[model samples]
Target chain A: MNRKELIGQIREKKSFLCVGLDTDIQKIPAFLLNEEDPVFEFNKQIIDATREFAVAYKINTAFYESRGIEGWKSLIKTWEYLPKDCFSIADAKRGDIGNTSEMYAKAFFNIESSGMSFDSVTVAPYMGADSVKPFLKFPEKWAIILALTSNEGSKDFQYLSSDGNMLFESVLQKSGEWGSKENIMFVVGATRGEDFLTIRKHVPDHFLLVPGVGAQGGSLDEVCRYGMNKECGLLVNSSRAIIYASSGTDFAEAAAAGAQAVQQEMEKWVREL
Target chain B: MNRKELIGQIREKKSFLCVGLDTDIQKIPAFLLNEEDPVFEFNKQIIDATREFAVAYKINTAFYESRGIEGWKSLIKTWEYLPKDCFSIADAKRGDIGNTSEMYAKAFFNIESSGMSFDSVTVAPYMGADSVKPFLKFPEKWAIILALTSNEGSKDFQYLSSDGNMLFESVLQKSGEWGSKENIMFVVGATRGEDFLTIRKHVPDHFLLVPGVGAQGGSLDEVCRYGMNKECGLLVNSSRAIIYASSGTDFAEAAAAGAQAVQQEMEKWVREL
Candidate 1:
């Protein structure tokens, strides 16, 4: 999905919510285990329940990869099941050298080759420009580079100061030159709400995929206040807090309730735009 | 493989050569395409030929992942076919948050879960300690962290000077505390031969998995001179140069000859010890 279409969806839905399907087999409702593909079954219901409120879906690849071939099968099926109108993100933090990265691009952005083509795939910028440029070769596809991540380990190397700019700030500045706002986005954790102020300074127009909300104790209000752009340039992701709201037969309904509550809150913020 | 066993293999084989099975479907011989599983068939031949000289086999996951389900099938088969005596590495440079990294660890380290158990897995260090620690949870497994890579883009963020050390130097310094020399390793590219002098300073005891030789124009002599230690702490990798040595029917023999040449050079380095 391109920037304009994404903004349109957010405006129409009145929410920038991107539901993260970090579905673990062990965490799903036990009854679902009786099904042939419980992981896919769980994702199908979660997508159906949250589709009304979300404008996008982010599938964390690690959750699916843990099951080997069976997990990979579920991942392909889940990708096929995602709502077409909603932007899709393969949250596979993948990057390598130029040639190898081309293979990764084929894996995620070329559905004919990899059986799944996400609108964007999360990329680690540690390997630098060539590692990321391959994903941008596809038209309208996005490369969401990791900036200031929400995890505690984000402090390890991301904050190292160089030439007065922190490592992530350098990532934001240097990577901005590699792709425009149309093809590039940054992953800015919502936990550090004020970091958005610093983030906006480098790439004001590019969308930021915000994680660390809900289960991670990040406030949606603070994210909206500091991160939201006129185009609603913030994809606030909520994974566990919404998907695992209930592990019983009522799981789908509970997920819908959780999503609706966040959507309603998001509606208030987008309404200002 | 543990530290002692890996060094023993290097000494036993009289080589520290790591043959990178970056097997691309398009690059394999056309006759192999007639087989039930061409990619795996090609890899099987390459491994059979190179097994004698190589102490390690590094499978670049991107090549297999590009083909989707069939590709993943090939990856598992390739992993299963790997010689039990040689150190196996799933060169999947994956890293994420703590829980997500745990899932990745299970994907590569836990055979019961992911259908493939590699001795080590390459991890991108952009997310820091928590993202890498999970891989170390498994006894006798290793996390080969990306410190300095071997591409033109490596200059983008890796060389950024922070305080008294460069970004890659800081990565080595900080990450050294995350795991011991036993469970931890760092990828120091062979292209920048002199950089090994600096890398050895921070990680004198930990093993360095060196890529960028042959196909990438790195020198084996220079890598050994500056990077080797008492245990000959280096696993130098060559992918395209050795694997794709020939495109005709003589491909396997050519690969054997190519691997033997590198092993001979490596033997000289180990002989000095």
Candidate 2:
């Protein structure tokens, strides 16, 4: 999906919500286990229920990868099932050397080779420019580089100050030179309230994929207050809080309600902007 | 796959060679493509030919993942086919949030969950300690953190000076607190000649998975002189050079000859140690 199309989706839906499908088979309702592909069935229901409120769907690859071949099949099926009007993200944080990275790009962005194509694939930036550049080679696909993650471990290296700037600041500034706001996005955790101001200083126009909202206890209002640009450049993601809202058979309805609540909150923010 | 067992294999083989199975379907001999599972077939031949001289087989996940479901099937099959005595390394540079990282750990380390159990996995450290700690949770499994990489992009943020140490130095010191040398290793690129001395200072006892030997023009002697430790703590990887030595029908024979040459060179280093 292109930037204009993404912005249009946000404007039309009055929601910048990107529901995360970090689907764990163990966490889903036990009744679904009897289905042919429980994970995909669960995702199909969630997507069907929440597509109206969500502008995008982010599939976390770890859950599928852990389950082996069957899980991988579910992942591909889920990708295929995702509403075409809504943007799709393969939340596979993958990166490597140039030649190797080309293969990774093919895995996520080339449907012919990988049997799945995501509009964007989250990329780790430690390998720097070459590792990330491969992802940008795909037309209309984005490379959401890791910057200022919300995890407790973010303090370990991201906060390290160099020349009066933090490590993530350098990631933002340097990575900006590699791709435009059209192609490059940064994953700035919603938990980092005031840090959104800092992230904007480097990437004012680029969309920021904000995790750590519901289950991780990040305030969506705070993220919007500091991070939102003229284009509503933000994709606030909520996984467990939305998908696993209730463990009972009313799971799909409950997920829709949870997403609706978040979308309602997002609508106020989108209107104010 | 523990430190002692790895050293034992190195001593017995008289080499610390790690054969990188970065099998590209397009690059493999055309004859194998006619087979049902060409990638797996090719990897089987290469592993059988090189098992005698190599102590480890680093399966580059990118090459397999690019092929999608069939590629993933090939990955599991390759993992199963790996000689039991030789250490298996999944060169899948994966890391995420703590809970998500646990799934990644299960994907590569837990045989019951993913149908593939690797002795170690190459982890990207951009997500920091918690992301890495999950991998170390498995008994005898290793998280080889990306410290100083061999790519041209390594200069991007790795060399940024913070306080008194470079970013990679901080990665080494901080990650050391997470796991012991038995469970934690660092990926110091072979191309970074004298930088190995700097790496050794931070991690003297820990093993280093050194990539970029042949195709990328890294000197083995320079790496050993600086990075080698008491346990012969180095796994030198060469992919394209050994695997693609000859593209003809005698590809397997040529690969064996290529691995033999590297092992002979490595034998001299082992003898000196």
Candidate 3:
């Protein structure tokens, strides 16, 4: 999806929520185990329940990858079942050398080869510019570069001072030259609080996919206050807090309630804008 | 495999050469396309032909992942077919948050879960300590962190000056505290010329996986002269120069010759050690 279309969905839905489908087989309802493809079945129901509130779906590739071939099958089937109106993200933090990275671009952005083309893929910035520019080559596909992540480890390297700016600040500043706002975005953790203000100074127009809103204790209000742009350019992702709200028979209904509550909160923020 | 076992393999084989299985479908012999799984069939042939001289095999996951589910199947089969005497490295270049990195570790380390147990997996160091420590939780497994890469983009962020040291140097210093030399290795590209001498100052004991030898124009002689330690702690990788040496029916034989030539040069270095 293009930036304009994504912004349109945010306005239409009154939410910039991107539901993360980091679905683990062990966490799902026990009854679903009898199904032929339990992971896909769980994702299908979750997508259906949260489609009304979500502007995108971010599938964490690790959950699917740990299961081997069956997990990969589940990933493909889940990708197929995702709502076309919502942007699909392969939260596969992938990046390599120039030629190798081109293969990764085909894996996520070229559906004909990989059988699933996500609108975007999360890329690690450690390998630098050439490693990331490969994904931007694909038309309408976004490259979400890691910047100031929400994890405790973010302090280890990301916060290092470099040439009058922190490592992540340099990442944002340098990566901005690779692609336009339409094809480039930053993964800024909501837990970073005031760091969002710092991130905005670098790429104010680019979309920021903010994780750690609910389960990780990041406040949506604070993120919106500092991170949101005129285009509602903040994709607040809530994974476990919404999807695993209930693991019993009422899981789907409970997931919907959780999503709706966040959407309703997001509606207030959108209204203010 | 543990560090001792890996060193043993290097000494026993009289070589520290790592054959990179970057098996691209388009580059393989056309005749293999008629097989049940052409990628796997091609890899099986390459592994069988090169197992004698190579001390390790690094599977670049991007090549297989580009093909989706079928590609994943090939990855598992390739892992299964790897010689027990040789070390297995998953050149996945994966890293995430604490919980997410655990999943990636399981995806590469836990054979019971992912049907693939590699000795080590390449991890991007942008996210820092916690993002990398999870991979070390598994006994006998290693986390190969990206230090100074070979690509031109390596200069973008890795060479950034911070507190009298470069970004890559800081990475070598700070990450040195996370894991022991027994469990942690760094990727110091052969293309970086004299940077290997600087890297050895921070990590004198830990192994180094060097890429960009043949196809990327890095010299093996220059790398060995500056990078080799007391135990000959280096796994020099050559992917395209070995795997795609020929596109005809003689592809596997050509690959064997390519691997043998590199192995012979590495044997000279090992003997000097």
| Number of the top DockQ candidate | 1
Report, for every candidate in turn, its global Cα lDDT versus the true structure. Answer: 0.94, 0.93, 0.92
Task: List where candidate 3 sits over 4 angstroms from the true fold.
Answer: none
lDDT string for model 2 (A28-141, tens) is: 999999999999999999999999999999999999999999889999999999999898999989999999999999998999999988999999999999999999999999
Using TM-score as the measure, name the better of candidate 2 and candidate 3.
2
lDDT for model 2 comes to 0.93
DockQ of every predicted complex = 0.92, 0.90, 0.86
Docking class of 2: high
Candidate 2 structure quality by residue, lDDT tens digits, B1-273: 898999999999999999999999999999999999999999999999999989999999999989899999999999999998998999999999999999999999998999999999999998888899999999999999999999999999999999999999999999878999999988888887899889888889999999989998899889888989878999999899999999999998999999999999889889877
Task: Give per-model TM-scores.
Answer: 0.99, 0.99, 0.98
> Lowest summed lDDT over 10 consecutive residues: which window, candidate 1 chain A?
A224-233
Q: Residue A58's C-alpha lDDT in candidate 2?
A: 98
lDDT minimum window of 10 residues, candidate 2 chain A: A184-193
Report the poorest 10 consecutive residues by lDDT, candidate 3 chain A. Answer: A154-163
lDDT of 3: 0.92
Candidate 3 A-chain TM-score: 0.99
